[model samples]
Target: MPESDPLQPGSPESDALFELEPRAAETVGFAQLARLPLTELVAPDWAEALAPVEDALREVLAFLAAEAADGHEVLPPPSYLLRAFRQPLAGVRVLIVGQDPYPTPGHAVGLSFAVDGRTRPIPRSLANIYKELDADLGLAPRIHGDLGRWAEQGVLLLNRVMSVRSGAARSHRNRGWEAITAAAISAVADRRTADGGPTPFVAILWGRDAWSVRALLGTAPVIASAHPSPLSASRGFFGSRPFSQANALLQAQGNGTVDWELPPLP
Candidate 1:
């Protein structure tokens, strides 16, 4: 689809899309979606709003369940699947969509490009992201890769496909996660203030995979950049200034700017 005009903060066009239908399945109650340990994966607040798309969520869980049944190992562990939504949904001020979890052991921790703890030798793509972050904000990069701070600051560090087979990248590419995450994106876009005021978010879409979901972000301002891989970082990601640009957009939308700083390494 060709790019449309940038969505105004509270334009009706954007609000209309906020009534998110399941992108790949029918809406149904959680009873039919199985009483799986979904709460263990997604935060309670988000799980309640996501109940409308229980069918798609069910498909995602079923896929993972089947994969586990077949003895296939999934990355980021099971409980961290919806770690992206650990913060309040209404607090989300920005969304960064990644393609999938890192395939390397001890690398995937639900949040995109983030590891479980302060680990050395972060993924190359994440290293590139650090470089861009420094260039964009004139701050020194930290040694650790846990981005939970960004999530707590209202940045939804979501991966379109949340998991992968251990050691195998893109192993779960064609599964139903795309639909489930897409619906989640729309849900965030539709979020309003407690008084029913407009509360738009900024979307930083990196790489082709992330850009593929740009259309679902409603009227939120979008900043697009090439993938932060060494192969492409210099081409566009280096100068993208996504962190600064996202803050600018958030301010323009009448929201508070995000403090993009990561915590210091212990």
Candidate 2:
């Protein structure tokens, strides 16, 4: 008995290779292919092509689930795993990284976060930052209206640690999330433009821990700043509005501004 060659046409290994019987080259149609298992119909290279992305996503989800099961709580349920994965990973022009998810449930909707204000009602530090940005860019109350405008300009708002604790307890502190953050930074660094050119993306680090991860970003240039918490803001967090400054830098670099306004502070 000897090991059989998998490439051989009539070998048992060949059956595994071609899970679906070859269509007689006449009856192949979209309906027939749609009914077949993806693994059977797709070329071997197809799986190979997606292997890296699939593997990275699995690693991220597994890490998050394990952290949660280990008593480390995240704001949105692990169910939001799909939504997080659905987010655009690469080619984003501006990247904003915060510390962790807000302790409030249903608040970490992946794309939106609480900012102290009449419109959004976020934390104090966020209010201060917005106020400073409003003055610097001449936008005050309008900043509260539509924060999603940043996303339209290719700004990706993400947290270094996607999980947070709730209520009067700090029991949901993240212990092993730094690794996932590092992985995400790596993924974004490797992302390319649709036309095969290098994507010149800018990253904003809002908190101390978030800013500390700059070493993990490799070649990505990061604009570091104090955390946007009441304590940090009081200590001059908004002294230099990093978001507006980054945009100004982008403008100077030939990337013109979009239809955005930095409203006046209330």
Candidate 3:
């Protein structure tokens, strides 16, 4: 798929994509074409990689729209639905896959295991991730929970389920979000860097849910561990050293490492 022009000022493409489908179809199926207009929901940088899964993505959005119409609160808001994809994957060297968005209000900021900078007492899983970062890389812990620094430095924080109903964990599972995210993972693995070298990205899969997509990664390196939730951190998540291992994997691919020393958001 060739890239479309960048959306101009006050373009209606954004609004049209988010609007609920006014279709009269009886059954929801993968092959069902979406009536929604997608002007540029995905950045042009990802057009080729994501084109195959676009249909499934639209269906998942339809399910989300229906949920919202039924008064179900969605987490992280719509503006952040594609937040993780804002950066081009060509520069992305690390892929960190999480199960789903945080169900609590104001917690999930579209990136997996990340939240608003001002979110107090960050989610336990994020706290444990901070602890592991310190242990693995000797980086001191900061007061904020935002992971934008890592994202900017080529780490992709993507969740298996892009959206979830507020206050209801895994409420949006079994929807079409999985197929969409699976395609994203495949894009990362199949991506060839500048000069046409082999793909340079590595994947850090957390928990069984995140690990489920491992088969999609053709030859990309992977680091897997139990989820960082309190219940399972003690089992294998605590001392897994995923951060340092991920950095090593990236370096092996001749890519620069992520700056794990994230400062408190200003």
| Best of the candidates, lDDT | 3
Q: Give stretches of model 2 more than 4 Å off.
A: 1-74, 77-87, 112-120, 142-146, 168-176, 192-198, 258-266
Report the lDDT of model 2 for residue 9: 34
Scored by CA lDDT, what does every candidate get? 0.74, 0.51, 0.76
- Model 1: per-residue lDDT, tens digit, 66-150? 6765777767665455568767787888889898999886678778878866467778898888888888897778888888788
Writing each residue's lDDT as its tens digit, candidate 2 over 12-114 gives 4323433322222112222222223323422343333334454443444555545444655445443232223233454257677766655664445444343
Which tens-of-lDDT digit does each residue in 129-198 have in candidate 3? Answer: 9889889988887778888888888789999998899999999988988888888888888777668766
Give the better candidate number (1 or 3) by lDDT: 3
- Clashing residue pairs in candidate 1 (N, C-alpha, C atoms within 3 angstroms): none
Q: TM-score of every model? A: 0.82, 0.62, 0.85
Which candidate wins on TM-score? 3
| RMSD of candidate 2 to true structure, Å | 13.0
lDDT, ranked from best to worst: 3, 1, 2
Lowest lDDT 10-residue stretch of candidate 2:
22-31
Model 1 TM-score, all chains together: 0.82
Off by over 4 Å in 3: 1-39, 194-197
